[model samples]
Target: MIRTERIDLEPAFVLHSRRYRETSLLIEAFGHDSGRLAVVARGALRPKSRMRGLLQPFIPLLISWRGRGELATLTAAEAQGEIVPTQGSATLIGFYVNELLLHFLHRHDPEPDLFETYRRTLQRIALEEDPEPSLRIFEKRLLQATGYALQLEREAKSGARIVPDARYIYRPDSGPEPWDPRRHSGAGISGETLLALSEERLSKRDTLREAKQLMRRVIFAHSGEKTLISRNLWRRRRSSDAA
Candidate 1:
C-alpha cells in the first residue's frame, strides 16, 4: 500500500507522546480524517517549542504533518477553541478514556464518529458533577465502535427481548443469556440494567454501578493483553480517599 504524505490542518487529539532522540517527540494521535496516527514532532522538547504545550492530551488541535510509512513528521499544531478542563477524579477518568483509545483503536483506521464522540464526552465530563455516567457511556460506545457491541436487548439462544425484571448472564464468548430459575449462577445480571446500558441511560445510582460492572467484564474480555493503567490508578486513589 502506498502511504500518502502531507496532511494539512487535520482536527486531532493527542492520545500519547514521548521523547524521541534529543529533542523530538513521537506522538500517537487520533485524527478525525486520518484516523489514529504516529507522528514525530521535531524539536518538541526544546524550551521554545510551542507544540510541546499544545500536544498534551484532551486538547483539540488543528495540525499539519508530512512524511510517510510507519511514522510522519508533525509540522504545525494549533490549539482550537478553549481547552475543556477536567479536575481531580474527572481528570483521571479522562485519562482512562485516552488509554482505551490507544489500546482499542487501530492505527491508520478512520473512526471519525468515535473521535467526535470522544471530544464531546470530554466536554460533558468537564461540566458534569458526576463523571460516572459519561464514563459508562464512553465505555459502551467504545466497545460498540470497535466491533464488540453487546447483545443488550436480547438473548443469543432464545432470541427474546430482554425482560427488565428478569435475571441474566452476559457470557464473554457468547452474549446475554436469560438465567433459568432452576440453575443459580454467578454470571446473572439484571435485564433492567442491560436495557439501561444498551440505551446509554443511567437514571438511577444502581444503574450506574451495574453499568460499571458490565463494562469492566466486557472490556476485560476483549482488551487482549493491554492493562488499564488509569483504572488501577483510579482504584488506588479511591482507596486512599476512603482511607
Candidate 2:
C-alpha cells in the first residue's frame, strides 16, 4: 500500500488566498521545499478559527498539510515569528514579488534557494527606504531560476569582457551587444552600470535606472503578454506625480 505525502510544519508564506465555500479558504502558498502549492484552509473564516490570523500574506508561517492530488489539505498553521511589518510601497512590492512567482514558477517544483532569496527580499523590503533594489534583485533571480537570465558580464558576439566605459544595447535573446553611437542617442546602457548590477551594486542613480529598465524588458518578454498589474499601477502613480 502507498502512503499519502504529508508535510508537517514546513516553512512557508501565503502568496494569495481566497474564500472557499462558506468558511474555508483556498490558499496559494510558497513552501521552501514545495515551491508553490495550492492548499485548502478548512474553516479558516469562522470567527474563532486560529488559522484565520496565520494565513495572511507577508507573514512567515509554519504550515502542516497532507494530500495526494492537486490541492492539499492544510492541517495546521502558525506564525514562525513576529511579522516585520511591511507597509506602504513595501507591501505593494511584496505583492509584485508574489505575482512574479505565481506567473513564472511551476507548481510543486522545489526551489529551496530561490525560496530563501524571496524570504530575505521580503525581510529587506520591510525595512528599506527604497524598495527597488530588493525588487530588482528578486526579479533578476526569478528570471535566472526560470532559465531566462540576461548576460551582463561580456559582449555577446565578440565574447570580450564588457568595458566599463562602453555602451551597449541589451538584446533579450542574444544578450548585450555593443551599441552604435552614431545610430542612436545615449539611451543604451553603460558598461559600468551593467557591471555594477552584475555585482549586485545599486548605489548610483544611473546604474539603478539602467538596471531597472533592462530587467523590466527581460521580464516583459518572458511574461507571455500578461500585464504585471502592480507594475502598471506603479507607473501610473509615478506618471500622476509627474503630471
Candidate 3:
C-alpha cells in the first residue's frame, strides 16, 4: 500500500510572506486548526497566478495545502467572503497585528484563542472603530495565551491585592511591584490605571497611555532585537495624522 499526504482546505489568514526563488513565494499562515504554517506558493509571483492576490494579509481565505514538513506546498487558495477594505490608519493597524503574529507566534502551535482574537480585531478595524482599544485588548490576550500573562490585579512582590490609590511598577517577570519613590520615578503607574486595565476600559486616557507603555515593554522583551517594520510605519502615520 502506498501512503499519500492529505490536503486540507482550512480557514486561514496570511501572517507574512517572502519571495521564494524568482517566481514563487513562501507564506506563513495562521489557520483555525492547523495553526501557524509555512507554505510555498509555486509561481505565485507570476502575473497570471491567482495566488498572487489571494495571499494578501487581513483577508480570510480557504486554502488547500499538501505534505507535512516544516513547509508545505500550496495547492489552491480562494477568498472566503467579502472583505471590507481598510485604508489609512486602519490598514496600518491591520498590518501591525499581522506583524505581531509573524514575529511572536511559533509555527505549528495551535492557538485557537489567538485566532479568534485576530479575527475579531480585524473585524473591529474594518468597521473603523478605535483600533487602539481593540489592538490593546488583543495584545493583552495574546500575551496571556503565550505564558506572559500580565498580572494587573495584585502586587508582584507581596502578591497582595492591588490598592486602587497607590502606585505600582510592572515587573515583566514578577508582575506588579509597589513603586519606590526615590529609585524609580517613571515606572510607577496609578492603581486606578491598573484597575481600569483589569476592567478593559480604554476610555480613560491616562490608563490607555500607561497600558501602552506596559505592553511595549512586554513586547520588546519577547520580540528579541529586531524591530517590526509595520510598527515604524504605523508610528510615521500617527505622527503625520497628528500634524
Candidate 4:
C-alpha cells in the first residue's frame, strides 16, 4: 500500500488563488507549520461554494488538505478569525508582505516564528496609521529567518558599536561598514536608522525613510530577478497622486 499525507485544520493564510480549468481553483497557502504549499480547491469557483468567499488573502483561516507530492487537494477551509481591515494603502502593503514571503521562503520549510511575525505584521498594518514601520520590521525579520540577517548594531569589519551620527554603507549580505568614497557602492544609511531598526523602534520620519531604502535594496539583492508587483503598484499610485 502507498502512503498518503493528510492535514486537518492547519492554521494558514491564502497567499493567492487562480482559476483552474472551468470550476476548480489552484491555491497557494502559507501555513504556520506547513510553510508554503499549493493545493487544488475543486469546484471552489462555483456560485454556491462555501470557499468562494472564505479563501481570500488577509483572512485568518483553518485549512485542511490531503495528498502526496508537491500539490495537494484542499479538503476544507474555515474562518479562524474576522477578516483583517486592510483598507486603502494598507491593502497594497499587505500584498507586498505576501510577495516578500513568496519570494524568500522555500516550500515545506516550517517557520513558526516567521508565521507569527507575518500575522502580527498584518494586524499592525490594519491598526497603525504608518504601515512602513511594520513592513520594514517584517522585511528585517524575514531576512533574518532566511539566513541573511542584517548586521545593524555593529560595524561589519571593525566590530565597533554603530554610532548614531555616522553615515555608513549597508552592504547586502555583509552588513554596515564605514563609508569609503571609492570602495562602497551599497545603500547609504545613517547609524541612527540602523540602531532604530536593530531595536525595532522605527517611528521617526527620517528613520522610516532610511529603513525603507535599506530594506528594499537588501530584499532585491537577495530575491534576484523577481520583480515585486505590489511594489510596482505602489510606485504607480505615488506617480498618479503626484500628477
lDDT of 3 by residue, 1-243 (tens): 544355677889988888989999899999987788889999988999988877888889989988766878999999888774778778888888888887778877899878988998998887856677788888888888777788889888788999888998887777888899898877588788787877788887778888888888878887885688998997888788899
Q: Write the per-residue lDDT of candidate 1 for residues 99-148, one digit (tens) a residue.
A: 99988998888999998889999998888888788888888888888888
Residue range 1-243, candidate 4, lDDT tens digits: 657789999999988888899999998889999999999999998999998878889999999999988999999999997889998889989999988888888888999899999999999999997778888989999999998899999998989999999989988978888987687665478999999999999879999999988888898899995779999999999999899
Give per-residue CA lDDT, model 2, range 127-152, as digits (tens): 98887787788888898898887788
Clashing pairs in 4: none
Clashes of 4: 0
Q: Cα deviation in Å at residue 19, candidate 4?
A: 0.7
The TM-scores of all predictions, comma-separated, are 0.95, 0.93, 0.91, 0.95
User: What TM-score does model 2 achieve against the real structure?
Assistant: 0.93
Model 1 misplacement above 4 A: 1-3, 181-184
> What would you estimate as the lDDT of candidate 4?
0.91
lDDT of prediction 1: 0.88
Worst 10 residues of 3 by lDDT: 1-10
Per-residue lDDT of 9 in model 4:
96
The lDDT of model 2 is 0.89
Score residue 190 of candidate 2 by CA lDDT. 91
Worst 10-residue lDDT window, candidate 1 = 178-187
